[model samples]
Target: MLIQALTPADKSPLLALARRIADAGCNLSESRVSTIGTEVSLMLLASGAWDALAKLETALTKLARDESLRLVHYRTGQRGNSAQLPYLVEVVAADRPGIVARIVEFFAQHEISVEQLNSTRYRAMQTGAEMFQAQFTIGIPADIHIAALRDDFLELCDGMNLDAIMDPVKF
Candidate 1:
């Protein structure tokens, strides 16, 4: 468990902290962020025992203090069960807002749980339009219909002028 106090107006510091956490060889478990007036609080969970992660914890605390943020707590091993789904979905399209919302909504409607989601934006070769790529690792129940999901995503791609590729997650 890691605690950080920040302000939404100072997002750079928070993001920098997140990056540092990643560099510290700890897997981020969960992040809960809330804002009140000009202050924001972030509660993060990472993998590792307190003693084992002491150096990292101290560094994070120092960084937080330097940024005028508060260090709340430092602990470890706090996370929920992850989905055991067997497939992944990759979607690429022109950069635009609401893409993630729509994709998540689609998955929700189908009762598919997202296990991991990573997205990036880059320049497209053809049109130079900002291209957005999202890779979703999801958990599909054994009883769920794959054909329906494929068809729905296909139709969605058609409507959005994007490309969606479904791939099986290899064990």
Candidate 2:
């Protein structure tokens, strides 16, 4: 199940919320939390029975109302075996908007699945230039030729002035 919550930037409330979910008989399988300015958002993947999910819904409703947390939840079905290989993509460039969007667009156009992504903006130590960087775990279908894909991707990256790399995720 996928659960999303927007809550105040405080520790106790989040701990209380976690307790509520545990008390409702749900196990938190995975979770990510990020804070932007004053507010924090959380995404949690939880597993539980149908009845437990219902109970959790009720509890979360009350928690949201009382603590002013915005909570939404839904059960997530498995996507089945992807039959695709995992590749890691990393990109760095002068800070500019749309860099991430363009990369994602390329993957989308190629019908690739993005399993995970992390991106950040920072000042470069060498040149003090604002830099944007992103890392992605992408799923590539079996039929595609990886060498051809790398060639095309590097060409595009060069055109955009982005230092980029794509390699298989090694064990």
Candidate 3:
């Protein structure tokens, strides 16, 4: 099952949620928790027998009501094995709009799948200049020509005055 919760940022809520999942006889398979602005967002994947899952659902409902959380949950299946190779793409450049959109478009045009992406803008400490950085985990089809793809990607980045690298993930 997949569970997502959003609540006012607090240190205790995560532990409380985890405890409830455990107490309900569910095993947490994966989780992502982040503090965005003043809210804490949680995404969790839990696995167990049907009864345990049902118990977890009940527990989650009670917890949400008690703690005033915005919650969403649903049953989900696991990802199928893929024949694509994993690669990491990193970009760094002066902060500007549409950079992420352009990068995503490039990968989409090549039929590559972006499995994960994280991007942030911040002021550089040294010069107090605004900077943008992004990291993408992409799945490249086995039949794609790696060198050609890298070349095209670099060309695009160069055109935008961005520093970028695309390399195979190591383990």
Q: What does the lDDT read for residue 65 in candidate 2? A: 75
Residue-wise C-alpha lDDT for candidate 3, range 24-142, written one tens digit per residue: 89999999887877888889999999999999999888777755688888889988897999999999999999999999999999999998888888999999999999999999999
How many residue pairs in model 2 have overlapping backbones?
A: 0
lDDT of 3: 0.91
lDDT-wise, the better of 1 and 2 is 2
For residues 55-88, could you state the per-residue lDDT of candidate 2 as single tens digits? 9888877776754677787788856896899999
Worst 10 residues of 3 by lDDT: 8-17
- Candidate 3 lDDT score at position 141: 96
Q: In model 2, how large is the Cα lDDT of residue 138?
A: 97
lDDT of 2 at 27: 88
How much lDDT does each candidate structure score? 0.74, 0.85, 0.91
After superposition on all CA atoms, how large is the RMSD of candidate 2? 2.1
By TM-score, the best candidate is 3
lDDT of 3 at 25: 93
Candidate 1 Cα outliers beyond 4 Å, as residue runs? 2-64, 68-83
